[model samples]
Target: MYHLPSSPTIRVLDRFSTLPDEYADDDQLVSFWPLLSAILLRPVSTTKDVVDALEEIAHVLRQSTGPAGDYGTLSKVLNALTFIDFPPGPHPGMTLRLSRSQAACLVAHQFLTSLASPRDRSEYYDFGIWYDSEQPHPRAAEMYITAMCVFFADLPDINILEEYATRDLEMGGGVSYVLASAPARSVGNTPMSPFRVLHNDVHVTGPHSPSSMDPNGALVVAANKVIGFGKSATGEEVTLGTTPEACPAVLVTPVLTGDQVVVITGASPVLRVTGERRNVAWEIPDTRTASADFDAWRMHRAGGPLLLMDALELDEHVSELGQVPDLVPENIEREVHKATTSFMATAATTVYTPLWGCGAFCGDPAVKMCLLWLAASMASVELVLLLDARGQALADELEPFVRRWQEKTAAELRQWLGRVPRTLRGGQVLAYIDT
Candidate 1:
């Protein structure tokens, strides 16, 4: 089971399993492979056991070279491993328990931080994932592999990520949106301000995307079979890249770290197309912390919701080669409903989406565009659609997409729902009525 095809940890271990130095030699770093593999076993294992294993790794890190290194780097990640109160959110109960599985992951990440730096973003590597087989979307395996090596092997510098965002905006990435025109806040261009939206309105907007790895609300990103954030190969996957932003920001920015890992893991897969996207619902403890630097200076991670919608299938191991869970109207409806509820609950002004299921996952853009509009129409939040930097393709797909729902009266909308083709709708959505 350690190498279970469906397990994120197994995928992680497999990547390193072949690396002689990482696992074979003494003091090579992966001295705890057996325990680490054991921690990721499914049929869900005990949390305390994983915690114990992590503590042992911590002991090694503390005694190895130095415990608290420069930037208190080791210390920062170590602190992130401790069990602190989960920030307040729509999922309050989920927040309370940082689950054993998550703890194992946090500790593994600390091991990485001790080896790397924030700006280095070790992903600054010389090579890519050379697949033993055709690695269609190597990101899934890469993400899990990287997760196991967070502070050690390779990490993408966060500042570089910000720079990427600015360049994307400037070049307009073959496509453009509403947010590009809006000025990047003076202090936090990388991590923009998150705001609350109480007013009921649908605004066609863009320029910013939750996928950009910076926004602080419920983020929507695709996941690989292992559920790691490395789903996007070119680093263009907005949701996946942005998923780590909130937690790491909180980890380094003292005001936000409540002595807990900034990550949140849902009890089950948030969206299981073929395999789980792992436990990546993030809740940084930045509920009340704000600065003159931040736009929604007062609104933190708790205030903003990061919604991770599992909308892709990169697991060649799953089923028929390209058969992915179709983002039918139902799945889209379900995701939108949850996102709307979270934003509404928190008064999050917008949901900066990057064509939720339209990327490598391959959801029909016209359909996704239509459904996205409907969902935002239903929720009435200012739905910000960020045609990503490389989203010329997506923009083209959505070119003919018309927000026709805005003109439809509630009664008429309901009637259209009934006549919609079977290909366009599903029962889960059929059962949902605004009233």
Candidate 2:
């Protein structure tokens, strides 16, 4: 039977203290670290023992999260899990927004089941990178062990603490999600919001993989899979094309269709406790320092709403584009334009975005920024672009255009983008405007 989750009950415990004997009466409350310590410390004699260890991990997760109420088992706490119950895919002109309690419940459900899938664990589990690496990443074992200790202790109350911390944001209409479409060609005088750059990762609160230096780590992709817990599974992957671009938990929302842009406001700037870059913070893992990385994410477990849009995975198409390493074709710019306008046109608030599609996706920063700027002008919503140090330089190169074109209407900018020389470099494409 299915059940809906409610607000998590907060129970405080001494951070450095050992498991107390008196608390044994509460089946719902499990001391996360001690149980894990016991499970890992035991010996594994055979392949069967290894399998049993995985089961033990799942059992521990179920115990820690506990059941929803008198009738709920922790594993069954969510209203739905498989795609059969929670349908996925983009629903144009629809919006699927969830309350804080509902979002937490969905995350909790993913915590219970996502790790159990062997395919998921094999491919996406952050810790697995360290485990399977032939020449393991530097200090891989230490990073894993430290994360195991600190991350779990923070889980039970993560949602409640986040709610308490972000109460002010929640009161101010909380996070809003809207899927918007491209702007019409007949643009008017929609004054663009001033653009600013910051040397930081996107403000969405989540942990990255320190060992391998990957930004979209457990916190971002799999909802804190770094904690090293899982439920047993029937060995099937989540059906493709029926899920969100990020974690399956995003499927929590009910209405998903609308315009082309998926704009989210009030996205929590997850508190940054370590060096801003993943490579800087996670490159040389130390037990003393690694725990802080997990703590940073732990403090903001109840994150704000996220806009789910997938960049074109351009790395795979390098063969088609030939020698121009960073060139963005005209079709690609349209996709970026669609992504920006949907959110900009409808939302009544400013949008915060990272350098979209510039990382592993291989997008050109200048092209992306131009497309976003044009789309926002059409929609008339303010746009704030988040950037790392490298992006700061690119922003500097483009600021001149931003100032010069401040008076240009959306229709004018759209026409300029259409005529952009595809052969010109991404940054150089904007330089053509002066000629």
Candidate 3:
């Protein structure tokens, strides 16, 4: 049985083609819009109805398939939408279906992902912010994508839609980093679990490997321009003039060298933010992280199932303290949007991060705190702003910030969601499989 509710509200829009002309043209979307509108108009909806509509959408896409790349993009869109809420019972019209921003985001997210070859990604770099010309604003793009994600990302409580993201992210593959991680069961156990944050979802923490500390969950870290990788110790320079071979899917994203949002899918690490390739690309062979900055995003890494986010821009010159490079409010907003967005995604159950900019990067922890606090504030995930090597000194430095984060930590806000293993009610299994 489904749990209780907050408040039931419903609204219906009669039109489907309400989106403006600026959105990228997609023949399939053009035809499917009306059907989508009808689905939303239902006086009442069932979980089955939601899946049927998705099937219809996929059916149409299959008919208009362009190439292998097109299929891949379509697949990701489908996958991301795999976990959607139908609001069990008679509630209807609770969707972002008609928003032009959502449509534009759809097009932007899908555009080049299906291309057979790499092309200039500058055109789609920035979405949401309408430009006089086609040139993009990375910051705008990050914000737009994050905003649109709320429409169908993860949600509180259990629903078929919400579970799909969890299923694909942890059990199989979807738009997440688990697929890019090492085998689920490396020590000869059953298959390893997929990367996801199933419970106690919130945000906070210090710099470290994105997936190492709590392999069961997800982490976010900085990257460096230098080609080498480091261990658990993040925010350092580890350039070794080496590069991982690019996977075919890297072409879908418009990544450039030293740009942020390069995701690793259990193998080689490739840039996923800009279209150009770096002379030397960074890779964390053992799942370590490095230094970089951001426009905030989660992009698919080539070769593996993990999607990397090249959010940080690398400060080329190492500083006396460290390369902290220039900081921008937009940069903070972009990354915060990501943390918030990922928090919404089922993949981020327990959000952890470090004192970002305070390392060799030389950024003021105070400035970083404002942005981080904004992210933690907006997120539903459990955030733990860790007191690592800095210890009491750093804690003393940001006493107010620490207190603020603590105040936010309550049972309703954050708690320990211990997983209780399951067993057969009948007792021990003394039988054998016939498979």
For candidate 1, give the lDDT: 0.31
Query: Per-residue lDDT tens digits of candidate 2, residues 5-119?
Result: 1112322232223346554335535445444444445564443343344345444444322221211221121212221122222111111234333333333333322133232
Give the whole-model CA lDDT for all candidates, comma-separated.
0.31, 0.39, 0.30
User: Residue by residue across 107-131, what tens digits does model 3's lDDT show?
Assistant: 3223212111225332222211221
TM-score of every candidate = 0.36, 0.50, 0.30
Tell me the RMSD of model 3 versus the true structure: 22.0
Tens-digit lDDT track of model 1 for 1-435: 011112223212222233354444343444344424333332223333333333333344233222211212222332344332212111101011132212223333433322122232333111122111234444343332332333211222223323343343343221110100111111111211221212112211111322222343333333232222333342223232332322222122121111111223211111111112332222222222223332222122111344433443323223334332343334544444433333344334456565565546656554454445544445455555555344554454333322323444433443444444434322323333222
Top-scoring candidate (TM-score): 2
User: How many steric overlaps are in each model, in order?
Assistant: 25, 17, 55
Higher-lDDT candidate of 2 and 3: 2
Task: Identify the runs in model 3 with alpha carbons over 4 angstroms from their true place.
Answer: 1-212, 224-252, 256-332, 357-362, 386-392, 408-435
Report the Cα lDDT for candidate 3: 0.30
